[model samples]
Structures are given as C-alpha cells and as structure tokens.
Target: MNTTSHTVAVLGAGTMGSGIACVMARAGHRTLLFDVDETNLGRGLDTVRGFFDNGVRKGKIDAAQADSAVANLSGTTDLGDLAPADVVVEAIFEDLDLKKETFGRLDGIVSERTLFHTNTSTLSVTGIASGSRLPGRVVGTHYCNPAPLMKLVEVADGRHTEGWAHDATLEFLDTLGKTSVVTKDRPGFIVNRFLIPWENSCIDALESGVGTKESIDAAVRGALGHPMGPFRLLDIVGMDIHKQVAMRLYEQLREPRFFPPPMVERMVAAGDLGRKTGRGFYEYDDNRLFGS
Candidate 1:
C-alpha cells in the first residue's frame, strides 16, 4: 500500500502505544488506537488530546493543526477492526507469547502486503515473526518512551523481513518525523545493547554499597553529566519493567552481568513497581517523585 493509502493501527493504548498513535496522527495519518480495557482506551485518547494541547499551548502546533491531528485518531477496543489497517503495530505487554499470539491473529486479518511491526524493547523480533503467518511482513519498530517526543526509532529487519515490507516500515517511521536506524535482528539492537549493560553496572554499584542513592545520583549527575542517575531513571521507567528486560537479556545472552540485581527483584516482589505504583526506588505522591 502507498503511504497515504494505509492507515496505522496501534494495538494497546498505554504510554508508549498512545504516544506512537499520536505521532502518526500528527503526521496526518489516519491512526487507530486500540485497547481491550475501556479505561485504558479513554486514557489513551485523552493522552493524545493532551499532547496536542501542550503543543498548541507552546506554539509548537497551531490549534487548527492540533484539532486535525486529534480528528485523525480513533480509539477502539476490538482487534478485528484493525483489519482495515495497512500497517499494524503491536505495542502491548512485553510478554513474548502474548505478542506472538497477537501477531499471529493480525497476520490472518491483515492483507498479505500489509506490514506488521512490534514495539518490543528486548524480545526477539525473529521469534515473534516466526510465530506469525506472514513472517516476511513482521519487523521491529522499537520506540523509546514518550514516542511522540523521542526522535529515535530503531527498525529491526528480522530473518524473514525484506523488500517492500522493510522499506515501507522505514518510510513510515521517517514520515512520523523520527530518526530511523535500521538494525539487524540482534539482541537489544543498538540502544539497549549498550544501555542495558550500563544499568547492570549501576545495580552492581548499588549492591556493592558504592554509595547511598542520593550520593550515587548526585555523582552521576554532577560528575558524569547524566541528566538522571541510573536508579532515578529506573524509577521512572519502572523497576519491574527494567528487571524483566534485564532478566530476558541475561537469559538470551547468558551473561552474568546482564542478570537482574537482587535489589530490583526485591523491590518488584514487594510491589514497589515504581511511579505507577507510587513507590519504587523512591516514593511518589503523584508528581513523578524521585530519590537519590
């Protein structure tokens, strides 16, 4: 399908998924945002509106343009409605089996030429693609958190991904005003490959009692010029999610350093999931609170 002829359907209306849908809609694409839960679907639509409103208030986007962008977005709770999409992006949970199953269903619904991409952070794109009927059409389009704001888009060409499917995916990302990096089907691709190791190192320091949370955060910010320290960043990203990704990476690579640290596991077990849960490495009373 030509770019204009295709609609971008994003499955899951959470932070990342909603951000992606907003990006597409802002780019003037007819974007569909789908979620099974009513509350999530409503929140996702509200997120899109809030994003454009912020842009307009900041003079980044005119009110007319922002309204049009929102008009381009439609939310739904049904996956079957996504059959009309020329490109479907699965941006739901990080569970591999669930993602594989979703892709399999999407493969059956979408046309043979319709491209499929997953916003998976660490799962193997090849594994998901292999599980689908149209493996050749399945690729990875990993976006960072706050997809509407983040410019980096990693495009993964799985073992079977090639030709028009691959090219079209890259084009789609470019049209969304993102900088696209085409990566081979490899563990963690580019960003996570290096960033994950750094997170692991931070965990080691914490375990070794290198310093208190405050000291470590201050040191990283002051000495290394990092905007936020590793632990503080983990709080925002959610410790549970971070640990899950680390464990999966460690499992796939069998590298000891990639192992999820004990403290992270402890926190997850205690239900200190992070900002979403109001407690994590640090405590929050709403305003995205952080700690040392």
Candidate 2:
C-alpha cells in the first residue's frame, strides 16, 4: 500500500472501527468504514458523530473540522465497496476464524499490494494470515480501545508477516499520532502480555473476597496510583470481551495465569456485562456507577 495517498478501509464498523476511520479521515485520508450489519453500520456513524461532538463541546475541535472529518468518512454494509481501498484493516469480532475469513476475502478483492491489518488483541496473527491468500502481506495493527484517542498501536510481526508490511504499517500508524511498538506475534504481545493477566488476577482477587469492591478500587487508585482499578477498567472494557480475550490468551499460551477466572464467566453468563449492561462488579446508575 502507498503510505502517501491510500484509501483506508476499516471493516466492522464497531466503536474501535469507527474511531480508527475517524482518525484516518481527520488526517486527510479517504476512509470507508464497512460492516455486514446495517444496524452496526448506522451505529458506527452515530458513534463517530457523538465522539466528534464531544470533542467540539470540549473545545478540542471546531465544528467545521468535525464536519469535514465526518464528510471524509463514509460507511456501508457491502464488502464490494472496499475493493478499491489500498489498505484494509479488520476491526471486527475477536474470533480468529471470522478475521481469517475476512482477510481471505479481502486478499481476493483488494490488490495484492494492499496491506491487510488485523486490530486483534490476542488472536494469532500467524493463524489469521495462514487463512489469507497472501500470508506475507498480513500485519497486526492492534489498537487500544478508544482508537482515536489512544496513542499506541502495537505493530505485531508474525512469523509469516512480511518485513516490508510491518514497516509500512508502523509508518501509517505513526502518521495517525500512534506510537508503534514492534513485537513478535505472541499471545497478548507486550501490553496485554502484562495487562490482561493482571486484570484477570484482580478478578480472581475480587471473586475470592479479598476485599470489598470500593476498598479494592480505592487501594489501587490511591495507594497504587492507578487511574482506574481493575474492575473499573474491566467495566469499561466490557465483561464479555474480558472473558473472551482471557480465554483466547489462556488457550494459546496454555498458562493457568491467563485463565479467565470462573467469576468472569459466571458474570458474563449472568448478563452483567459491565458498563454496557449497566452492571458487573458494580452497578451502574444511568451508565454511571455510584457505589463500587
């Protein structure tokens, strides 16, 4: 992909997908955000608008800039429209098989030179590339949640991912105000290598009744100097996502430390999916929690 004037396509227009699309568009790149579901496509647009509105309200961006940013971004439910894109980044579900299928199809649709990126957190980039027609072109451009705001994009180089592709992806991410960290395509890579396990252990601590929710949160924030406690972070990350990513890491590494504790599974099963569901370790009052 030409790093200069490439049209970027972000598949799966969820929160992360939309945020990435917005950043690319704001950076003067033509962006197309696509999803198979119309509802999700619509929601993605709403999400982008809401985010820009917040920025405008906060005096971070002017209305004209927000309007132009929105104008540069377009969305669709069709994959055919993505054929002309120079780079296609899949920010869809965390499932390995789904990403593989999407990448395989993108390889056929886009030019062979187009860069394929997966915004996957834990899944194997090698496995995703294994299913692609051009394994060498597949690169991991894993972004944190709130993609437009997060400055780091973990650029993973799987065994099969081409060196050139990694360099190009790192450059692109850098252009979008992201700090790219290169690492081998290992489960959890670097950030999550330490983070996910820590969060999982915190859940175990809570499940084991180590302390009350408020006490745990206060200790971490006040004593540990953390911006947010593990449970609060999990609530923002969503309980279901935490459970799934934990399982993926545990299964890949076969390490018990990475295991999603029973508490998480039980909570997800109970439908208390953190902030989104208005409850998890703490209950949400109008999406804002009162007591921990």
lDDT of 2 by residue, 1-292 (tens): 3457568999987657887887788777788999999987887777777777778888898999988888878898878889898788888988888988888887778898888888888888899888788899899888876577667788887778877888788778766778888887888888887888888878878889999778888888998887677777777677888888888888888888888888888888999987557788877764221112
- Model 1 lDDT at residue 17: 81
If candidate 2 were superposed on the true structure by all CA atoms, what would the RMSD be?
3.3
Per-model CA lDDT versus the true structure: 0.81, 0.80
lDDT (10s digit) by residue, model 1, range 1-292? 4556358899998767887888889999889999988987887787788788878888898999999999999999888888888888888889889899888878777788888899888888988888788788998999876577668999988888878888888877777779999887777888887777888788779789998778888899999997777777777567777887888888888987778778888888899977657787677774222221
Query: Residue 120 CA error for candidate 2 (Å)?
Result: 1.8
> Which pairs of residues collide in candidate 1?
213-292, 214-292
Which stretches of model 2 miss by more than 4 angstroms? 1-5, 208-227, 281-292
True-vs-predicted CA distance for residue 267, candidate 2, Å: 1.9
Strongest candidate by lDDT: 1
How far off is residue 289 in model 1, in Å? Answer: 13
Clashes of each: 2, 0
